[model samples]
Target: MTVDWDWSYTGDILPDLLKGLRYTIIATLAGYAIAIVLGMVWTLLRRTPFAAVNQAVRWITEFIRSTPLLVQLFFLYNVLPSWGLSLSSLTTGIIGLGLHYSTYTAEVYRAGIADVPRGQWEAATALNLPRSRVWLDVILPQAVRRVIPTLGNYLIAMFKDSPLLLAINVAELLHEAFEVGSKSLMFLEPITLVGLLFVAVSVPSSILVRRLERRYATY
Candidate 1:
């Protein structure tokens, strides 16, 4: 079967595609904000001295990391309303993405923390620094700087995965492409555009991360 290519159709749907791109960016940024903060909390919780609490946190993080994100999204979108906690599709997508990615970010944080020199902790103790001050003033600053490239890579990954939000009708880039295809019967243009959009964003971001890694390696 010969497919008739439609250049005009691509032009017609450009606006809708751009609108979807906006939503994708919003979801990525908001979700990443939640992920970064919550990941730090999870890392801190897991590092506490209490064996049972730390173990529980480790187990939960592993569970979230190991499970499929689609299941988590469906659970957040469908199950929460039954408990009387309704959320808009966009909100649900953001929360689900945030929580799911937080597990990965927590692992990143844990690795960064573990990479810190043992002598630094001993020096902090010798200086009689409070635990909170030791972490905030000494540990976290260095740890966060070291992990920025990894976090940036995750941000790129999260941005690409934002299309999964369409499963719940969040209307991100790929969702808008589907809507355009459904109405106009021209799936190729919109779908191709979506792929290009992701590549355009992700490629440069990835290059930046690599550059950051190289620079950090120097110090």
Candidate 2:
């Protein structure tokens, strides 16, 4: 069988794909925001004086990192509503993506925080700086800056992973592509376009991340 490519069909499906891409972008940004903040929380919790708290947080982070994201997504999608906390598919997807990646981000944060010189903490202690002030003003500023490029890489990964939300019916880019192709009985155009669109976003993002790595190399 011969395959024919139709530019007009591609144009016709562009808007729907763009709509799905919008959801994909939104989910990625929201999820990544949560990951960054929650990951820091996990890192800080692990550093707490209470050994129990540290161990518990460490175990939780390990468990999350060890599990598959899709499994977590399904669990949240199914379990939450039964507990009277039903979330929209998109919201659930965001939360799943965030929670899964938070474990990875926490490791990144731990590395960045560890790289902060011991003298920095000693100096803060000598000044009698409040713990909160030391973390917020001295530690986090450095740690976050160092991890920004790595986090940007995760953002791109999360964007690519957004299509997995279709498993829970979130209607992201790949879902839209599937629908268009299924209805039109033509998979090539929609699938190829979806791939190109992914490249369109991720390539520029990767370039920016490389620039950030260079600009912050001295930090």
What TM-score against the true fold does each predicted structure earn? 0.93, 0.93
Candidate 1 regions exceeding 4 Å error are 1-4
RMSD list, candidates in order? 1.8, 1.7
| Per-residue lDDT of 204 in model 2 | 98
Name the lDDT of candidate 2.
0.93
Query: Compared with the true structure, what per-residue lDDT tens digits does model 1 show for residues 32-54?
Result: 99999999899989878999999
The per-candidate count of clashes, in order, stands at 0, 0
TM-score, predicted candidate 1 vs. hidden true structure:
0.93
Worst 10 residues of 2 by lDDT: 210-219
Give the alpha-carbon lDDT of every model. 0.92, 0.93
